[model samples]
Target: MTTYIPSLTIPSVVLQHSAASVLLPIALGTAVGFGTRPSKTQKTYLALKQPPLRPPPWVFGPVWTVLYGVMGYASHRIATIGLRSSASPAIVETAQNSLTLYTVQLGLNLAWMPLFFVAKRPSEASIDIVTLIGMNAYLAYLWSSIDEVAAWCQVPYLGWLGFATYLCVGAGYLNGWDLHDKEVKEE
Candidate 1:
């Protein structure tokens, strides 16, 4: 009988240098936000209308983990891109503009957790959701302005936020829209 030897296969290191910088903040946001507050109900609700193409609940964790990693590193890539670029002034200006928008949106993305989970205010969360949606929209526009590869990374996030907006709107209405409004007016 002939003995067979098996070879181990190692995956190629396709990730670029900028991957860590871009994805770090995203991962930080996730860990900080989730660790600060647990939202069992919210997670379930968010998954309610999840598209058929979307991954399962368990899949979200790992997928987002990797995505955020890429995002953080990619952000660093963009930040340094123009700094070291030998390109024209116009090109550098474009890179600067893109980075500004990306950074701003990332802040807004990070803000959603506090508004939604810690505050436990669906109405406030709904407003934040709208704001985050707009932020993502601007980020998308900025991505298109800078590089397709970078902008494409946000597609899954935007889609989740889209469904999340609807859930927040529904929950906001369900929780109490006018109660807080009346109190605000009284004050």
Candidate 2:
């Protein structure tokens, strides 16, 4: 089976720096999380019939913050070490492909908030999260060859995505796949 590799949207030079790479996802995630209107999102969240073991709303912020930072640092490592001049061409190619996957998955990660919260479309959100998980899993595998630590960084994100999938599917199932009907007050 042939695997499809995505082109990197962010320049490799930009990602080589630790601060830029680490902060990119964190900044974007914060922007999206706040931009979506937290108050309304919270209201909608409270109204939904969540499944067992769902974390409280406040927990998500801290958890995501840490995950973003870790994943960002991982990307930095991959770009810095794997793309170094002495590395083989094959390693360099893999690193570039890994970063491309990372960038795309990060975008998907950011999009999930709007789909689930703003649009109130749990079904679509579920699909997005599922896809994100699959892509990240493959990304981690690719990173393993170039940089082990970089690959390890994906562990936390992947673990959270697994739990998130359960929460998303559970909420969709419990709410009849319609968050709009929930009694959240209009802004």
Measured against the true structure, the TM-scores of the candidates, in listed sequence, are: 0.65, 0.94
User: What TM-score does candidate 1 reach?
Assistant: 0.65
Model 2 pairs whose backbones collide: none
Error of 1 at 166 (Å): 1.6
Runs in model 1 with CA error above 4 Å?
1-19, 39-60, 177-187
Q: Flag regions of model 2 displaced more than 4 Å.
A: 1-7
Q: Which candidate number has the best TM-score? A: 2
Q: Give residue 171's error in model 2 in angstroms.
A: 0.1
lDDT of 2 by residue, 120-169 (tens): 89999999999999999999999999989999999999999999999999
Q: Write the per-residue lDDT of candidate 1 for residues 33-145, one digit (tens) a residue.
A: 57754455345334333323544446545655665665655555455554345756865666566555555556666666566555556677777778877876776666565
Top candidate on lDDT is 2
Q: How much lDDT does candidate 1 score?
A: 0.56
lDDT of each: 0.56, 0.90
**True-vs-predicted CA distance for residue 107, candidate 1, Å:** 1.8
